[model samples]
Target: MNSGTKQHPWSRYVALGDSFTEGIGDPEPASLGGYRGWADRIAEVLSAGTDDFAYANLAVRGKVLRQIVDEQIEPVLSLRPNLITISAGGNDVIRPRSDPDEVAVRCEAAIERLKRDNATIVLFTGPDLGFSPVFRGVRGRIAIYNENLRAIAVRQECVVADLWALTEIQDPRMWAPDRLHLNALGHHAVARSVLSALNVANVLQAYDPEPMPDGTWRGARTDDLVWARTYLAPWLLRRARRQSSGDNLLPKRPTALSLNGPRA
Candidate 1:
């Protein structure tokens, strides 16, 4: 930790990644682009302090690490941010043919570039997918991916959010209706995690999610059918067509600007 880091807020904070960083599932009607995920939450808090803070979020949903590197790494460096975060590769690792070693190397490379630019790189270990029935097949791969992230953080001196360690998020309520993304409460927990890692005090507490429907076996089966009909089927169709949810989407904040204070 730098002596002056606490004395001054980050002048420029750039966030780069995929849907997780893009604030999916946690929709905020008032927020720009109708999303308010962890990065936005943290940025809001940072901007509330006495020191000025400029923030930019360039994350889009469904991005892989290579695509992030190809499309974003240079842009983030160009912004010359004091703090930058890179959280991606979830989409990549889940593929049937993914190579863990290659993905790890790519992640490390991204961190190395951030270090070269002299930014405090904050990385995230993907959340444990074992809790999701549909994602169970990739649980082993995700474990390996999380392991790689921890090792990379140790070697690169980057902060890892360690989402897998947060038992609070394992609950069904932490997930969105689709069971693929996090709901508002889950995003809040992740924001708290990131804030804690940055040694920032978070007044934005993680709260109990809104009450859910029946959790009994019969209820579960009913809900599962609903989910498949509502979300999972459409998602699979999109994947079959090689269309991304973010194909036409743009970053919520394409340029850095002073956050001034928390959004109401």
Candidate 2:
């Protein structure tokens, strides 16, 4: 796990986003409940003990950009994280009343607030929802969202993770049965992408892109993956399957289940 260079272990990281940041499709779901996620993985790679640094994942499912600003962003400022990673905007895209321009503005404001604390910020854009049949007609909107995110990253001097491009080249197995959420492999891909962007060491050193158990899709089965399925994937699949079968399990929205953004 060595990077052939001296690097100080990160002492604190505050992760902000939705379900994707929560590792929704990881194999074993129980492990991801508390502070577990890519941010936790990165923290472990950089440091030896949990007390050495605090990694907090302040993400919740079905949270839009405004919600993150109110809930996660404001409270985390007090932690004074040495590093921060935000994976947001998916819910904003999927919601029926989503205004892309307002989302961009909110995102920009969030980034600015983070900058005031002077932590190394990594801002991840939404993945390519276009690849899924559910999001078939809104590829253009996804693209515009990503473009605005990139602009904000540039303006605010934040590192950007090109999640859209990374997911675009992947096969179907990378996504969960619901197709909107990332499977185990997709989560690893996202972790690696973020690590590479930050020049972090040993984060993905032992990464293996394999599928989960129960004859599921293709991807890696890291601890994070195990956590994802046990907790997050089952409900997602149930909802998706129910919706596909014309069952009204959840609230009715303007878009199909597949078009529900990045499972976040």
Candidate 3:
């Protein structure tokens, strides 16, 4: 007589980031198919054979770096994820103050916390916004943030995905209309890129040919891709313009209202 039981190979993953990580505007109904975010795609690619692997996407739209560290990340760690993917700092760099040092500190803290649990961590640098017309002034800020991120990744011995350089040369159409988030094709590209980095870092096992597609996997079609790309890309561009203009129109604070204002 034998007992019946199944064992899962790679079951637990935790994803951390802001809007991009959350797959904002990818579409409604967060299922396996239809606008699957990169993290979900990665989880699927890696956990193809195992039922044990589970992914928890803790990303919140519009979340800045510090907010994620304080609100979302701590609770996720209690679950003891085996793998963690963090794609934060975009909101931090885009904010008016956009303090790179502060962002780095929070990211470092997240990494340390995850490492304490013996989790394999992957940190994603922001995509280069140099191509975006509205994000021109903050382009330099992105570079600074990447530098800090790279230093921290090195120190923590974690994997760093250089999405900044990869997406920079790609066509702007790869981005959604918002010009910030990625469309389906872009998400697929990101998934491949991140998977490759994980493989290179020896965090993930080499890919084996997947079995014949059961009715389970619902890959997005061209029409879905086009719609996502066409609609969201422009929307992102418009949003970026509004944000840039708002930054430009901001009035200088009165001395009394400023933190450094009115010397005692």
C-alpha root-mean-square deviation, candidate 3: 14.1
Tens-digit lDDT string for candidate 1 (24-133): 99999877789988888878777765466789999999888888898888878888899988898898888777887689998888888878767888889878878787
Residue 25, model 2: lDDT of 53
Cα RMSD of all models vs. native, in order, equals 3.3, 10.0, 14.1
Candidates in descending lDDT order: 1, 2, 3
Q: Give the poorly placed runs of model 3, Cα more than 4 Å off.
A: 1-9, 28-35, 200-264
Q: Pick the candidate with the highest lDDT.
A: 1
Lowest lDDT 10-residue stretch of candidate 3: 255-264
Using all chains and alpha carbons, the TM-scores for the candidates as numbered come to 0.91, 0.73, 0.70
lDDT of 2 by residue, 1-264 (tens): 244323654567777777677666555543445323455455455454333545666666556677778767766687778688887777667555567777888888888988986888898776666655556567777778889989998899898988877843256667665555676677766776777787864425323556544443353335346645664566467555532221222211111111111121
Candidate 3 per-residue lDDT, tens place, 97-189, comes to: 768778778778878877977788888887777666667788888888899999998999898888886752255545564555775556656
Q: Output the worst ten-in-a-row residue range by lDDT, candidate 2.
A: 253-262
Using alpha carbons, what is the TM-score of model 3?
0.70
Query: What are the lDDT scores of the predictions, listed in order?
Result: 0.82, 0.63, 0.62
